[model samples]
Target: MALRKLPTHFFPSLQHQLRPFSSLNLPTLEPSNDAELVSKMLLHHHNPFHAMESSLQLHGITLTPHLLHQTLLRLKHSTKIALALFNYSKSLPSPPLTSTSFHILIDLLAKVRQFDLAWQLIVEMDQLSLSPTPTTFFILIRRLISAGLTRQAIRAFDDIQGYTQTKTNSDDFCFLLDTLCKYGYVKVATEVFNKKRDGLLPDAKMFTVLIYGWCKIGRIDMGERFLNDMIGRGIEPNVVTYNVLLNGICRRASLHPEGRFERTIRNAEKVFDEMRERGIEPDVTSFSIVLHVYSRAHKPELSLDKLRLMKEKGICPSVATYTSVVKCLCSCGSIEDAEELLSEMVRNGVTPCAATYNCFFKEYRGRKDADSALKLYKKMKEEGLFVPSMHTYNILVGIFLKLNRFGIVKEIWDDMKESGVGPDLDSYTMLIHGLCEKQKWREACQFFVEMIEKGFLPQKITFETLYKGLIQSDMLRTWRRLKKKLDEESITFGSEFQNYHLKPYRR
Candidate 1:
């Protein structure tokens, strides 16, 4: 399908809204602002160009490279919309896009299954003597490494070794190390980093990516060690570096919460304070994370306190900052307070994403507040700003099932399909879990079968729970059907459901 050319009115509107970069001081404009504008523009549905034009003018916003980058970073997972903005911007008359834009977009094409288009973009870049730095080997390494093809990623890395720089000191080396680290190949990424580090000049961003890799895999100690090593080299760990470490501590605590949950929260707070001590004031990300830390520890007071401190310090709270506080409020069952904070977020000009509202759905589920959840869902549709996502429907269905509102579960399920939201892994997991809890073994088995039929490998735990439920079920026909399907899938109540994974195909 051809995307319509930019409407005639778009250019003057965008150009007028965005004063020439020089006049407005491009240096200070954060990409997140532009990215958010683009994100909201996506709500238009018909033409993203029109959506973007109207959104920018409606908000009287300007687009600068920095703001665009931040918004794209936030919308990285919203690839379709991001690419739409990317394409839409290519047709614009002001604030010309850069090769860096192409670099990240090229880096992301595989994620959106745009292999041929990715190549075509590369070819176009090559024609302009601006390849955005992707060799075929780069894409191969990313895809192969992502598939746990470490040997192949390495082999492909070797294929592009004809460049002038020595293998260890090249940008290719950094790319290889970074990609390796990104996919939980941290052990291997560490090996690659160490081998390259013997005489290689240190780069903080390179180290930051590795630190994030380790932290991503729940190895906070290794992340800390890297931080220490970076600091010892007379290199200052930037705010981003600290945020990575903060996330590491938060992840470690989340995974190993002893019900007390205090230890991790303390460690996270220590990191937050350490940032201040080092003259690296915690940014919005830092506050948001600590907010999450406080929330998880069930310290709603601490969460609220940090939120106020965020405002007092003049650190503008990002959507994440507000959402984390909202989540905490909802989790702590301060539903009224949560609603107020959400309102505050909007009044403060922070647009709520689908995730922010999902927090409320989760709370409604906890309290079996179906009417409230349904009311919110209706409002989300009517408001047209933040569309309910797959997570939304899954939460709604889960809420109904938990409340013993089975009829509404069917309604939500149909609505989900109608809206083209789910039946994804979480959807299956929630359904299976909900059905098992309700002892609705027959419907549970039905979804279990359909889940596998759709090529979603069932989580072993869910399979076990369902299989056990089926065995205990009085519905003999459904049990036999599920048993036959399980046989085909190599899943038994005892075995790891059909075995081999697959969090990133399950990473």
Candidate 2:
């Protein structure tokens, strides 16, 4: 017998159908109830199933339950798809919600704000005997809280304990409590936390969340009480736990007394030493938090000395660590040291991003040296890294406009346009102001018309610039016509414009 080739259109259609099944949001296939069709589909299935699996993997879509159920129903009840799902799930960081995949569909529906359909999916999961896990309950709990359904979220949490063996973590319980607090349900969150804390082991992570929440709500003293209780209960404080406590103290100190702040800083150092003694490594964030608090509190010299201490303790500084030092130099008007520190950053292989240049530019704000600023700008572009943001263009524009280098200003605008940055109202306004300063009233007025045609209605200041330019050039007719238009449009001319144009005529 000769083999028959399948039609070209037939294979392509099958390939297209499988390419984005989930993205296209296909309907669920009732595979278990269909047998004859299943036999026909599975007759020559190995190659087709392999092809489908490979294509779906490349597209980053899993063979969802609907996809699986249909694929299995149309073919023999084999575990090929199951095995494929396992391999794909392993490649991800978070473990796949395999047992509760149907429940997850409900979670996804909820996330997309399709609450009614999501409830239907929850009911479906119950019917299928695929119980929801704590993670599953957490999802619905968070969504309900976000939607302002505090009562519903709590009720859902109460019912979820019956669904799975996976014990709800402290964070999960705290999240519910926090939601209760947010919706004038503070007593409820407090009550729940007290009960859950008594029943479950006090996790440091959960304590950090509660303490932060309390501090945020102007209850720092209450948060401190919780902190002391956690430490007294023999639960060792982690970096986050200490950091939260320190931050709360620092915030209170800022608003209240200098003595309290100084004592807090001294106590913070003691806590740092204790963290090291207990064999808990202080991460870069831990170091940065202390440095930031000290720096903001007018203690940069101490912050710098602490950086040295951090390095001595075998804790390497991060880019944020180095950037903080450069910013401090800039703030102190030590531009030379700030520039040198930028060099140090590059040498240390902490390549400067746009933010580094932003600080550098701010230090040179009044210099307005086109040659120097443009050279630095070109160096940044040549590095083939650190694409200048909109602020960068604005700063350069201001510099050249102040220098009355209109040609250079236009060139900057051209470059900005090519970079896919359309001139904002401010950019256009700046250019028009520059034109008016040079007494090129005709060009300034034409630019104003062009800006309006480009869908940007000029601000009062923009029109004020044009009106002043005309009057200064002794083009009285043009000035009166513009004033009439302003009156018709109800645009108020401020004293700033009168001081620029009307003052000379009064003298």
Candidate 3:
């Protein structure tokens, strides 16, 4: 859809208010005095153009570039008024507008979506031989890209090359390329890079950003091509460049079958080894990515080997590093080893995050070690290193429910509320199912109502469980009321519950 053009009448009233300035014999007030008087007038007048004209006539001052720039700054909040003020200043006989003033007005116009007027001003600047600064072009290009006008932004960038005085540097090219790539316009970004590459040499960080952008969109081949191109250009790849390629390879590996996955990992490891050979020492991020790859490939032993090597190299394992290894250990049923690693992490002053604790929680639950799971939960709260996520509460609720510990289940529910963790679908499901199983109909009904009010639609199993308990407890009135509410919500009990007959009750 086309953007609606700004209304013409938006400025007519202000334009009429400034018309009387033509008749006044304005004097050449000092620039400082003119700025001071205009600033005062701006505070009282609703229309900035009106304030500027009134100040000029009263002080008998002409709008010099310095004075006009000051007035533009004062009126920067309203684009329409600023544009009117700029146009009106150009019509004055003394103290004409300068390139600096034009730059400010054009930027203001672009900001307010008045691109047509801004382009006109740029053309005017060119005709007057007023060369735009590099900063001016940079701001214009960035704003254009942000407004989803990539084509216009590219055109504006091309215009910059025509100016002999304004030299576009590496930073200027990188800024536009980065913005374009970030917004999923990689092809456009490539065009920009190609346009400026001969003049502005691409640095390592620039190559890294482009490679990362390609990797992000799952085009690993393009990323590799860029890496090779960088190498061919005699630009040595840095640690970040290799890491981006490694991450891309690992991510692609994850999507493939076992045979292809192994091949991908081998390719990634080659890059890793090559980086080390080149004396670009691996950082914590490099190690983390390798460990994650091994974890995904289901090679816990290899992950352990990497951890040992990481420690040997004096690179400390981060929370992510430990978490990756812990997850690998748990997945392969090496729960004891995982626990020892967790203990080692604590001994080394590294606090295990919520995810780290949750990893152990799942393993203990799977092994039917209820006591151990409860101990871990207590430790999580006691340490207060991290708040338990909703998943944490759901696990505890499920474990206590299976153990038939009703009081503990309620306590966990209260804890979830106190910690500001809103119960999700599974949380409500477990609570409702557990309460109904224990024949606590009143409490079950309260939670059921609360769940619906919070916009959670109970599954068919939830309806069946609640219906069975209500009928068994002979709460015919409560069952009928619940039925009416469900009917109002357009939800019907599944056919599986059709066999059960309910006693009729008066409304």
Candidate 4:
């Protein structure tokens, strides 16, 4: 099949003339059928502007609102096509302009980051006595907020108010506040919230969002102030509201330095107590936050106590809850307890995730208990609980390499492939490092070449292992060949390894 050649404007061409729609050879469009045809052309063509021109040639001066809307929908991601269509529609004797068509074009322009054109369309709509819909305002507001144009978003909101003469709902206000908070504009969000709250009765969810915003910025005091203000305004806080504040307080406390760790944990505990006393029932998330505080404070026993209390309260522990307790138990050198909890989690019909297994793997690896780690790996496979991830293989590889069991390493590597887990950069690095450590220069070289072929550039540690292994194995000639290939590929090995000379292996 032969490929169709596009026109010169599709690519950069100095000699190509830019012409109006009237000068182009366009088709006369049937308002009903040709809109669908134009839509198809825009979808399949390389230059949608050219597609629009062709459609115009087929349906001269018959551009319909439906056709323009369809074309705009197809070209929403292209600013050039949108502007071309806009200009082409303007050239018609009686342009088929409607609110729906203008909305589509404005949305298309906004999506392509041509905000000025979209705003101009809104102004034009106003002049024509056409009020923009809520959807049109939403699209503009979201785009402006996403682009970090808070001031422009505020202006648009005000404009929307003037156009509709109706009060904005809680969802709209919440969206604007959330966007401002997400982009670290909490102060601006507060001002916007205050401005809107005067006219609209602020709800619990709205207050919760503002509290979360303050908490996100580590302003716990400010968050608390809002909480109190909400109560003063006779709004009852929900479980979600309490959980948000609890999580924020616990997170801030966890980040305190060692000297302040105890003090911070105590503060988090006080908040937890207060939450329960306020008649707000603690959920799994609330318990998880408190459990995390206990873990960070090096109080695994306390975490276990809380776990008991959680069950007593009939709050079923989630996978995250089990994982947290398991992690704390492992950190405190209580592997048996952690393993017992893992079984308990399964018995309760809650499947352990990758993170749960990783906690056991890391603990076993740290203790140099490869046998236990392997048993867990086999158990993971035998139980069909979850497929072993790259981290699982990496831990096994590191352990086998440390024990100098190259044969087992090879077996695990084969198992990794048979299990359908594609090796990432870390996997390749580990295998190459393992092969080099065993002085298997030829095998290491093969893996190195394969790694490069897979498009992963070796890091400094990879090169260091290869350099040391090759020099010690008296494979100087092979090293020179590898260096030459690296140089040709423009791959750097850093200055430290670059200056090192090959010395004769001392027997």
- Highest-scoring model, TM-score: 1
Q: Per lDDT, what order, best first?
A: 3, 4, 1, 2
Query: Which lDDT tens digits does candidate 4 get at residues 98-182?
Result: 8877777666556434576687888888787777765567667766765567898888877767876766676667767765665
Candidates' TM-scores?
0.60, 0.46, 0.47, 0.50
Q: Model 1 off-target regions past 4 Å?
A: 1-185, 196-202, 216-219, 250-279, 436-449, 459-507
Note the Cα lDDT for every prediction shown: 0.64, 0.57, 0.69, 0.68
Q: Which lDDT tens digits does candidate 3 get at residues 366-431?
A: 887888887877776787768898878888888887777777778888888655454765678778
Which candidate, 2 or 3, has the higher lDDT? 3
Residue range 1-507, candidate 1, lDDT tens digits: 111121111111111321211121112224344455455554344232243443333234555666555545444434445555666666556744665555455555543334444556656665655533335447546756765768757765654444212243445566777667656787888876777677677688678877877887778888999899888888888887888788777744653446547677678779878888999877777777777777766778988898888889999988877887888888888999999998888898999888889888888777777898888887777777675777688678767776788887888787665443455656777788878888877787778776654335566678567656655664556656766666664421123343632222100
- The lDDT, on a scale of 0 to 1, for candidate 3 is 0.69
How does candidate 3 fare on TM-score? 0.47
Where does candidate 2 stray beyond 4 Å? 1-132, 143-151, 162-188, 251-264, 273-283, 298-302, 323-507
Candidate 3 Cα outliers beyond 4 Å, as residue runs: 1-219, 222-244, 251-261, 273-280, 382-385, 401-406, 424-426, 429-445, 452-507
Writing each residue's lDDT as its tens digit, candidate 2 over 1-507 gives 111121111111112221211121223334343333332343334332252453234234444444544443332122233323334444555534344454444444443234555555565556656665665666676666655666777778877767665656655665566445433344456667777677777676566656655655557777788888888888777766665655555544561256755776776677678777978666765676566556556555766787888888887776666666666666666668778878877886877666567666665665555787777877776776676766678788878877777787787777775453445556677778777777778777776654543323455556655666676678879767655544432211122223323233320
The model with the greater TM-score, 3 or 4, is 4
| Residue 448 accuracy (lDDT) in model 4 | 80
Screening candidate 3 with a backbone cut-off below 3 angstroms (N, C-alpha, C), the clashing residue pairs are: 27-60
Cα lDDT over the full model 4: 0.68
